[model samples]
Target: MTQLKNLLGFLWYVAHKFQRDRCMQSASSLTTTTLFALVPLVTISINLFSLFPEFVKVSQAVRNFLLANMLPDSASRIIGVYMNQFSSHASQLTYAGLALLVITVFSLVITVDHTFNAIWGTAPRRSWPSRLLIYAVLILVGPLLLGLGLWGTSLVVSTSMGWAGEGAQATHSALKVLSLLILASGLALAYYKVPGRPVKGRHALLGGALAALVFELMKNGFTLFITHFSTYTLVYGAFAAFPIFLLWIHLS
Candidate 1:
């Protein structure tokens, strides 16, 4: 009973902190920045996969996984088509154009760094060179890690299905769990590492898990709203996907 009270207290405190930090504004800013950076990021990911032929299948799987799990049925198809178009155009960029794309991507990272710093009440700790290196590593390695995770999860699911004769429902449940865990783990790492001050790992983990749970709930609620409501489709027509995508990014 005491532990439950403590947990409630902690949650209330975190909610207060989040409100005080103007996280909604930060999220709005992130959504705007993401709109500009999405194509470049996708292009980069596509280029990375191209360089590693063995991982091409993993990349495709990751895309499919995200579309199926993270997005609403209405938004996923339209967004996927837009992403493919943007990435194709981005891939043909000249060196100067590529540099601009990199800059645009860096702007998103800088915004994120500032947002985290604001939430933590800390100044930037890393120098520009170090920050650049870290950002580059994150941009290049993050998708690869996600692809590998998807690949591994697929392998496990396949093996399990073969051994246990599990049905599609079991496979989907496993994938959902994997997605939740991966989201939570990534959030935990960011919570631990992004702040200038030291954060306890357990605290970060707890916060991350809670946040991931909330995000999953939000995603489901948003999907349900979109599924039932055709207002956006009626109002925006073909461009409805853009706003829905932006709203999802902000909520996320």
Candidate 2:
């Protein structure tokens, strides 16, 4: 237990220090890494389009809001193309998706490796055999982990919906609450999983919860911003808005 505590402490230390450099070095790497890392996430996006109009609606609202508020005057032309990346759902994980995933993971791994290198203040060096082993693990394990997570999330929702009584119906009303947790969990995992580090479970959970909280708050805040503050002219301007959103995420 003590050892676990120490490990958690160390993870927190690295993450805490990360916040300082996030907008500077770490965030920059993370932003680049995440764009690549998350291309795979879009594989699910296509299926999602058929199932959830609500999600696309909310996402567009967010996009429209951000485009208006944050982007500058010069970037308006590229808004349609840029927003497409966020909204895109290809029919299959074509060569392009696979290519994007490969590049993304490669970039993500390198960023993490450097982040760990900085954190431990050690030379960013590894034996080729060891490096290959790690690479093998990531390739094999990453898909399994992601699939497992999706399955687990599905089970949770299933179990909750199984409740049949009147009191349980009230509990059913809180399905979104479960979604809240899952979203946060996703964020924490993203934080833990993105970098080169092998984060402990406790630290991963903690970080995920925090990330989720921040994301939720931003969701509502951004929602409010869109509904009240955003206008047609400002919303359509892509150049100014996209970078600001990227910058904000980098900070996160």
Candidate 3:
């Protein structure tokens, strides 16, 4: 009971800090930046994987996993189609065009970095050259690691299903758990690394787990609201997904 009280107190304190930091406003700005950068970022990741023929399946699996876990069914379908089309065109860009693509993507990252530092009440700790190097390395390496992880996960799931003769439902449940864990880990990494000051790992993990839980609940609630309420669909018709996606990004 004492531990529970302490946990609640800590969470309340964090909530107040987030409010004071204007995180909602930050999220809104991030949503706008993300909307502009989404295609360029996806194009870069896709192009990176395209250099290696063997990882083609891995890239496809990663895309499917993201769509399945991150967005609602209808929104995911619409966005996936548009994203693929945009990325295809983006991949054909010339040197100058590709530089612009990188810049667009970098702008989003810089926004996130600034927001994080503001929340932490710290100035930027890294020089521009160092930051650029870090960003370039992340862009080059992050997707490769993610693809390998997902590929390994798929192999493990297949082996597990084969051994146990589990049905599709079990596989899906496993994937859902995997997605949650991955989200939590990513959040924790961000919380730990983005801040200029040192943060305790356990505290960061706690915050990440809490945030991930809230995010999962928000996703389900939002999906339910969209499923039951046809107001957006009625108003926007076929273009409802864009607004819904924007709303989700802001809320997230």
Candidate 4:
């Protein structure tokens, strides 16, 4: 009974920490950035789902959905155009989205670094020249960084494919293991480079790697828990992804 109570207390602490850690101070900017992120998120989510098998099963139904209840004719037409484009050559769209998403994410990453720096008492000199330099670097290098990150992911996936006979999930556990670290490295680069502070890449990389590991473990654990234990509405089932992803980012 004592152990159970302690565990519950720990979970509550984690939830509270998540709420506090989320970059809510930059909410308006974050929302705009998230909107920008949506294109890539959708692109990546669709591709990953098709590869993962779980999402491919419902893609047709999902497509049928937007086609049915679309509001304005113009909006519907745009969606139709997007869908057509999406189905024809997903890689092109994914690449485009990946390019855009990287810029958006790096912008946010810099903001996070600035905010954290300010809060942590090591705020950098943000003179006009330095600020301009930051903007220039962000605009020029952000997309390239994103492209490299995506290429790294593609390499892992390709390597996984050569080993697996049919299923795309045929990669070794080791490959799955390295993917998180690779992603963390990209994030660490962004975090370290974006900040005006003197944070070293090694420190940011370690922090990012730890955070990524916990986030992945927690995400999978929560998914398994929901699949095995909980039940929710039939109509609004798909939005579960929102809360899960949001919570992970918040907490992580």
Question: Which one is best on TM-score?
Answer: 3
- Kindly give the number of clashing pairs for every candidate: 0, 7, 0, 0
Candidate 1 ranges beyond 4 A from true positions: 1-15, 163-168
Residue-by-residue lDDT tens digits, candidate 3, 66-159: 7888777766787688778877686578899888878999999999999999999998778999998988877777777776777777677777
TM-score of 3: 0.90
The superposed Cα distance between candidate 4 and the true structure at residue 91, in angstroms, equals 16
Q: Per-candidate TM vs. native?
A: 0.88, 0.48, 0.90, 0.48
| Alpha carbon lDDT at 105, candidate 3 | 94
Per-residue CA lDDT of model 4 for 220-242, tens digit only, reads 66556656754642544856544
lDDT of all the models against the reference? Answer: 0.82, 0.54, 0.83, 0.53
Model 4 clashing residue pairs (backbone):
none
Question: Which sequence of candidate numbers ranks them by lDDT, best first?
Answer: 3, 1, 2, 4
Poorest 10 consecutive residues of model 3 by lDDT?
Answer: 162-171
Residue-level error in angstroms, candidate 2, position 251: 3.6
**Deviating ranges (above 4 Å) for candidate 4:** 1-110, 126-175, 200-202, 234-245
